[model samples]
Target: MILIVVGVIMIVTSLVSTVTTNYKKLQLQPTTESPGRDDWHHFSTGSYKLFPTEVNYEAAKNGCRNANARLVTEGIRNKVTRKSIMDEMILPAFNANKLGEGYGVWIGLDDLEVINKWKWIDGIASTNDNTAWAPSEPNNGSERCGMLHKLLKWLINDEYCLVANAYVCEIAKSK
Candidate 1:
């Protein structure tokens, strides 16, 4: 019986080895991930502070999610911090041709189903306008896209999922 058991063990070992080899032979190489579906941004204090680019809202949100960050917004009351984010991330997000007194960066800013109750992609809720949006902004009904108004105010202007200009991305510090 011991001999039979030993023979079985040897057979199992051989089988496992054969299977492993075949698996190795069929191993697939790692493929590059697809780019964002929407515009996205990435901001890190230690890493690059600002990374802004054009993308769809969903893709932009996903990019932030992949970085383990929620979307940032004006609901955050600190004017200085929000301004820094705008200067570093939003202002420089686009090239010289893109940057202007008129055109602005689309941030994680938005007003959801709740009217005038602004929200950020980071899940912040605020009725206060701290981030800047241009005057007469946020005129669209149920529009959710947010852009820097002037410099510090967040303006609700575009549709929630509309494709727009560049965007600003922010990464929250891990608590």
Candidate 2:
């Protein structure tokens, strides 16, 4: 009976020690990660921040690439999502610049690769359900680029890729 108790005690003690060791190891693991910049901001929809500086489409894309991000691409789809992105991301910048209704901002979408076949730079699939084109937009023009046309109530429209315009850059927040 004493032997059985001793064996049971030994087993329990072994389990306790193992559990304690594992707990300590887990505690030593890093719990918090930092992205290193406080100026970066995000909206509640999927947590991505926009760079408000204006530039032409190519230059803006290059700028975003330099910053380890890409031009804004994730939010504009249906009218609701488009409005959300415009209100949350583009409108604030426009308000800050005191820009007029005719102004536009370059987005990460373009049909440059194939006419009328728009694609986001982030590789998000383009579908009828995921499009927010203004009526008569993607209008088969030589522009071959997409922008959030403020005059059209912040809807997506094709514009000249080389046109100098304010752009939004999207940086995904690290988990």
| Per-residue lDDT over 1-175 for candidate 1, one digit per residue giving the tens place of the 0 to 100 score | 9999999999999999999998887776454453442343333332222334556566766665676554555323356666566565555544344544343555676666576666665565644455444566666776676755444344445554566445544544542
lDDT of each: 0.54, 0.71
Q: Distance (Å) between predicted and true CA of 15, model 1?
A: 33
User: Which candidate leads the pack in lDDT?
Assistant: 2
Evaluate residue 157 in candidate 2 and report its C-alpha lDDT on the 0 to 100 scale: 83
* Model 2, residue 140: C-alpha shift (Å): 3.3
Task: Write down the RMSD of all candidates, one decimal each.
Answer: 6.7, 6.1
lDDT of 2 by residue, 1-175 (tens): 9999999999999999999999999999986554543555555433444555556789978986776667777655435445666776667868787443335877788877777777888777667677677798877678787888878877778888877777765565421
Candidate 2 stretches with Cα past 4 Å from truth are: 1-36, 44-47, 78-84, 98-102, 173-175
